[model samples]
Target: MAQRLPSAAVLVLHGGRETGAVPPPPGPLNLPGVRMLPFVRAVRRAAGAPDGDVLVRRVRYAHRGWNGGRADPLHDAVTALDALREEAGDVPVVLLGHSMGARAALRAAGHPLVRGVVGLAPWCPPGDPVTQLAGRDVVLLHGNRDRTTSPQATQSLTARARRAGARTCMVTVRGGDHAMIRRAPAWHRLTAGLVAGLLGTRSLPGPVDEALRLPPTAEATLGTLDLDRLGARPHGGPAPAGRR
Candidate 1:
């Protein structure tokens, strides 16, 4: 009999600016469905159900603003993770976060039940070095043309993670801006490939390899289009007719 595929749980946390109640733009950096629903869909497709067993369980939390107050968003995230672990019943867990949420995922890495963490466009705020990541597998994905959070920030964090003894790799998407990845098929492909690899699924080229390439100017202009106009609310709900 074939060995059963190990169950995997995935938790996604969204990032937002500290001041605003409305939340920030969703893009490659944040996977805000308004901005990157296509990429999210691609990732879901890539993390296919394992043969005779479910390979993935997904959970998402999108904070309206930065949890700079007494209630630590990180702690809340850990609590949610613990709940997910209990619900999963011994399945391996993978934590995925973008931007500020990535910071929370990094802090949650030391949890005994977690198998790995993926940080997309992670930004490390000033704090004690992330010592919890030691011995865990981590993948950091960032766009080279990202202006919101520079690649340098990710490089520095990766270096710090390495020094803390974490097994980590940083993948840079070329000619890709923070939000451009959502429009370019390559972004979906890269993300799907990464998730599939982690899930031990058969490797396949992402849709980007065959998608049309937009020039830098056009790519930048794509950001001007308000994703909120796409008819979906921030976390996958229907938008109010007049709101978008």
Candidate 2:
């Protein structure tokens, strides 16, 4: 019921094959679950954002892989992003993608509408160029134990992006695998935190807010709202010695 300034948009892209879209004749069951909806919902709920302040779009690719010639996932994503930009009217857009989609998001990060990118277990091959990501804030989260797409690939990608003048950080998900099914909570927490930080929205409930230890840019509203009761010292408050 309130109007917020500096509106933002989030585009969520899912992994390949396992999360690809169905044919023209579709039903409700056709929804993408492999990684798309879950991530979008988590970030949306965490932000608790009202309409017009933050908008989210779940991208359904034309094909499963980025290599699909005419049906390339990247092309579909770019078209979706263009539509999103037109709808939001120049609002800052944050791209959130997993696996193959993650790689595509990184490639499209150079779009003027995009300000930040969050890649979950992205499939970034060693030789993947990073020039397209220049000037964008990038965060890559990969399961150290991921066999589907080596964590090393994301590490190398981060390194190259940083070298290309992008503010980049790669977070290793300890003992987790590519899907991150076991440590889903932590994965979602980090994703939601990043979304809140970029969109200037409220952080979700529970200990995750304090656990994230997000910067003021992300936690300012949370701090003012006293949402971080688990860690009162986060808002420039006095901390008693020996307090845990």
Candidate 3:
């Protein structure tokens, strides 16, 4: 069988509820999925996948929410990965998700195809399961003032994730909101830089790279990285040798 040719793949996931039913026949639209359009665009432009080597796709979910123990979104993510693996041959994949979608991505990162996961304003509640993320690159960005999702909860999870043997880093978005409306460009830029770095298309911003390199110490786990200080370049040309 002839293998498909994208060198790398990125699945941009959207956010949804903790528990909710997706209406039949789409009476209500998949607004959660719709919210990720800009992210898809930003990644496409920023990833700079050489010769279009990176195939960026948005995973569509059968259900709108996580649906409690059923973990509806997780099933959908894995299904998407299964299909991606079938179509793209043996390329490494990066999972980028927002809020509820972030939770699903984190849960699904254990898939063989996934290299890492980036969560934006994720819903990493207590005991969300860190074992699935072992040996994976986990990057989380949460707004300090987000009322909908607790930033501290994600920080706690990152701390645990670091201990669990995952290369982890969390950025505290100051003055930002849950929806990423405030400081939107910063969120998008940071996300793009992180994804590009994960995809091996560009070098990671200094602070992020340093944070990830830091040993899983108490200070590193509890500490935060500055978004601006990370030197988030809008257009990173290309990655050098031995960059992950």
Candidate 4:
């Protein structure tokens, strides 16, 4: 029987530490990678691929760290994107990444098949490249009280990405912390909506759409992506949009 391919793909990436450790084969262990499993499950359930197609996959890293300039996760993510083309046949892909994973996704967003990226508590440091994000849609969700990753860094990256010509915005999770255990469902829902929307399974979320409509570096609060009735929404706004 011939293999089935979904119309789109989402590469889910988990967080890692700043230091290097040659990784063993990717499997469940450690807090960073393990913490991302829930979000992955949410994406699988909501990614909207028909007939149980594989719409989402996790990126397996060569090392658990950014490894400074080596960027093992970034390399791994690029390899995955290449392999995905072989598996899915040129389908548009959205990257759903957290912390260090988000950092790698943004760095690897230059891949030809990448149409969008959703960064969860991204760890984009000063001087990280923004040039690659041009023409791609970018969404970053950061918890205001996250001590592990700076929410301000995410906002900074969003601004830089916008200036680089990517449609980009950062949504602050009001009471959310680095682990996202606070208001977890809201984060999962918003991330999933952003992923599916970017894949064209549904229309773009409201805030993201609004941000896209604005000129580069334009500042504005987007309501459409968070257009749901979830109580955890910023200011208790409406629930999310783009449900499957």
Candidate 5:
């Protein structure tokens, strides 16, 4: 029998200082530690996203230049998203972004395919403004002790998003840092709860409950090639099958 696709699609945007550049390190050393995959996986599981139905697409913006002056990464992200939507055909999509990526995701919320957006430690871009997010379900998540982006900045952005007429929710991870959700269990729980709510799942009583409900053995199978190992090779070039 053919596999059934998920009803919802997710586009994950990774945060970075440089536009259209490689994503920065995620964990302590700042490596690309599944930036938003874990959260996406958790949400999918909680919401019981059908196999093959739920697709996770990651978009990395190109680095414009040293001055950070260039066409908005959001525009580039939106274009990529448009292609994904065309391929999926009628599936509702959730846009998730971290740091600078969050800002880009917000800017792209007006896209016809987007149903909602989740912004983690989002960074506000100069002149981009939050008005573009009006009428969308926007969730702003941040760590209270985040030194990199600062909670104040997130609050300011959230307020602006709300003013723009977006249905907004702000979640502040207590005693958390820039990478708090990745480090502490408490922060992770908070982040998971927020994501679950956005995905419209019944809230798990706690992190333990959430863990217990996850599939005992689940693995992510890449299409035919492992993009990570292949790096910048052309998409259709000859490549090893199923090996990253």
Candidate 6:
């Protein structure tokens, strides 16, 4: 078969509930709390994205969560990425996912075509692989007020990725929750900026506020510790052995 020429592609993955069942498709309006629609639109309309140059696609999961079972979210992500590569040729892909989807994007970052990954409130537990993402640009955004997935998980994951030689950065949203509905504007700005930066379309705004750079008040109190002691584990297969 004739191969499609390479072009840029942005793959969006959405966070799932703990049900382990398929999620309803996102509505067209991109409403608040809609799995991943808001984020997908944010990136698509980001500043500096050239028309006809970038393709944004969202992954539909067959089941919720990364339970390490057959046809799980992670499995669906891989399948989506594989199809994307086939259709787009050897194009550079920027992955953006939230929560469980974020975890799946991080796990899938090892792919050669993946240029960068943007994880929003990712559920990155200890022991996830960082070596696979060596030398790749990785950005993580988490809300300080998030209870569903702690920002510490992303912090640990970022520390490990740094150790593994991946260029990594983490941003914390003040008073933002798991859904980021509280600081919706901030969430959209950060996500859009990260996507633009990752795709090399434009650089992220600098001279940011101190609060955005630091984690939540409570987590910040516990001075930095050794990440190696955090039980960093890398799964041998497509997904993590345990669910968050």
Tell me, what's the RMSD of every candidate?
12.7, 8.7, 2.4, 4.3, 14.2, 10.4
**Model 1 TM-score, 2 decimals:** 0.67
**Residue range 1-244, candidate 2, lDDT tens digits:** 7444447788888776534354322334444344456677877876554454678777866665565334366777789889876665788888998887788888888888888788888988777678988777777777878989877778676666766766566666677788878678777876777666545454323343242333423322222211123242211222223421
- Global CA lDDT computed for model 2: 0.66
The TM-scores, one per candidate, come to: 0.67, 0.74, 0.92, 0.87, 0.68, 0.76
Ten residues in sequence with the least summed lDDT for candidate 1:
204-213
Which candidate do you rate higher for lDDT, 1 or 6?
A: 6
The better-scoring model by TM-score among 2 and 3 is 3
User: Of the pair 1 and 5, which is ahead by lDDT?
Assistant: 5
lDDT of each: 0.56, 0.66, 0.82, 0.78, 0.57, 0.67
Give the local distance difference test score of model 1.
0.56
- Model 4 TM-score is 0.87
Q: What ranking emerges by TM-score with the best candidate at the front?
A: 3, 4, 6, 2, 5, 1
Q: What is candidate 2's CA lDDT for residue 171?
A: 65
Model 6: per-residue Cα lDDT over 1-244, one tens digit each: 9543535788888877655554545565333227466667777777333465678888877655565544276677778889987787788888898888888888888887888888888988787788977767777877778999978878877767766766666776767788878877667766776676566665443321121233323242232322122222211122222310
lDDT of 4 by residue, 76-110 (tens): 99999999998778888899899999999999999
In terms of lDDT, the poorest run of 10 residues in model 5 is 218-227
TM-score winner: 3
Superposed by TM-score, candidate 4 places the C-alpha of residue 206 at a distance from the truth, in angstroms, of 1.8
The TM-score measured for candidate 2 stands at 0.74
Residue ranges of candidate 3 with Cα displaced over 4 Å: 1-4, 23-28, 49-51, 220-223, 232-235
Clashing pairs in 2: none
lDDT of 2 at 70: 46
What would you estimate as the lDDT of candidate 5? Answer: 0.57
